[model samples]
Every structure is written in structure tokens, then in C-alpha cells.
Target: MRPDYPLKTDRLVLRPFEEHDLDDLHAYRSDPEVCRYLYTHCATLEDSADRLTKTLTMSELTEEGQWLVLAAYLPEAGRVIGDVVLKWISEKHRQGEIGYVFNPEFQGRGLAREAAEEMLRIGFEDMKLHRIEAQCDPRNEPSWGLMERLGMRREAHFRQNEVFKGEWGDLYIYAMLDEEYARAS
Candidate 1:
């Protein structure tokens, strides 16, 4: 589904990534700490530019395997602080997934949660999804903590699931169903 642009929360704007967001996208994506748990390593400016170019095409989700990625823009800061993503994983099963990454400068402010919650809303309310889930490295406390705060129950913990950063890594999966979302709302 193509979301109405500029999905607004109390303190941030969730919109599609743009050509102009390169610098801001690089700001956080270039940080080693931010990229530690992510699949990609710290990105160079050119890398961020390449990523932004691809992100430009991910603004809408019209079919399975597509991703809808939005920029988490803080107007007062006059820049994009992070991004939120929803993947249309399975249309027949009505399943989707949510994910996010924000500048450390913007952490501890609930902005990531605010942006991610909107993705959940779009998944369950707008897209009529049956289930939505999020997965993160088990050691990423802040990420899992935010999932708990959003009322997503811990669904699984896979030990040494894959090679990450050249070592085995554990994964934590959290999820919420449409009925669960209705109750939480």
C-alpha cells in the first residue's frame, strides 16, 4: 500500500527518503556504533549516496517482497534523524515486518518508537495485515526494549543463528497480531 506522505507523529514526520537527505542519512549510517548490529558495516559518504538512491525506489509497497521505507524527519532539527521500514513479506499470509535505525544523537527520546508505531499502524490498520514482527540482535537492548514497550511479545530467540560481523550471533524475534494490536490500541 502507498501510504499518505508525511505521516505525522507528535514530534516527527515520517516520509519517503529523498535525494536531499543524503548528508543526514550518512550522518548516522556512517557511525560504526549504529552499524554494528546492522548487516552493513560503517558506510562511506558514497555508500550512503548509493543507499539513498535505492531507498528512493522503496517509498511504496504494492507487492510481496517490497519494502516501504520512510525517513524519520524531525522538523525542529531540520534534518532526517533516522528511518523506519515495513516489508510486505507475504500477501497471502497477510504478514509484514517493521524495522528502524536512528542517529544516536536522537536515541533515548522515543522518536524511534514513535516512528515505528506508525509502521505498525500502517501494517495492521491500513494494509489489513494478520501479523507483524520485528527482529534484532539479542544484544541490542534498546531495540528489544522498544519492541516490548510497543506491546509486541517476545516470540523467539534463535541462538547462534547466523554469522554476523565474523562471529555467531543470536537473534530475538518479537511480534504482534492484528487482534493484539486492536487490544493495545
Candidate 2:
């Protein structure tokens, strides 16, 4: 399903990535600290451009494996501060996943939470999904904390589940069901 563009939140506009967003996208993505817990490393301008191209086509989630990515644009700042994503994981099971990343400059202000909550709303309400999950490195306290704040329950903590950044890494999974979402809402 495609979201109505420019999904409006209290203080931000979540929209599809545009050509002009390259500089802003690169600004934070190039920071090593911002990319620390993420799968991707600090991005160069070229890397950011390539990633931006991919995100441009991710506005629609019509099938399993597709991702719906939205730029989290802060109006007062007049630029994209980060992005939120929802992945269509399983069609039959109606399962999805939510994720977000914000510039360090905007980190503690609850902007990521605001954007991620919108993705959960889209997954449970608009996509009509049975469950939505989020996974993160166990050491990424802010990420797991955000998931908890969103009302998702900790579902699992897999020890040394995968090789990450050249080392074995633990993963923490958090999930929420549609019924859970309904009750919480």
C-alpha cells in the first residue's frame, strides 16, 4: 500500500525522498556515530546518492520484500532530519517491520519516536498487518528503548545471532500485534 505523501505529524512531515534531499541526507549519514549501530557504515557523498536513489522507489509497498521509506522532514529546520521505514515481510502472515534513523543533532527530541509511531500506525491500520516487529543491536539502548516506548514488547534476545561490523553481535527483537495496537490506541 502507498501512503498519502507528506504524512503529517505534530512537528514533522514524512514524505518520499526527493532529488533535492541528497545534501541533507548525506549530512547526517556521513557521521560515523550516527551509523554506529546501523548496518550501513558512515556514508560518503556517493554512497548517500546511491542510497537516496534506492529510497526514491521505496514509497510503495505492494508486495513482500518491499520497503516503504519516508523522509522525516522537520519544517522549522527546512530539511530532512532522518527517515522512517516499514518493510512488508510476509503477505500470507500479514507481518511487517518498522525502523527509523535520525541525525544526531535531532536525536534526543523524540523525533525518531514520532516518525516510528507513524510507521506502526501505517503498518497496523493502513496495511492491516497482523504483527509488526523491530530488531536492533542489543547495545543500542536508544533503539530498544524507543521500541519499548512505542508499546512493543520485548519478544527475544538472540545471543551472537549474526556477524556485524566484523564481530558477532546480539540482537533484540520487539513486536506488537494488531490487537495489541488496537487496545493501545
Using TM-score as the measure, which candidate wins?
A: 1
Query: lDDT values of the candidates?
Result: 0.95, 0.94
Tens-digit per-residue lDDT, 1-185, candidate 1:
78888789999999999999999999999998899899999999999999999999898888999999999999999999999999999999999999999999989999999999999999999999999999999989999999999999999999998999999999999999999999999
lDDT of 2 at 112: 96
Which stretches of candidate 1 lie above 4 Å from their native place? none
For candidate 2, the per-residue lDDT at 42 reads 94
Residue 101 Cα positional deviation in candidate 2, in Å, after optimal superposition: 0.6
Question: Considering every candidate listed, which one attains the maximal lDDT?
Answer: 1
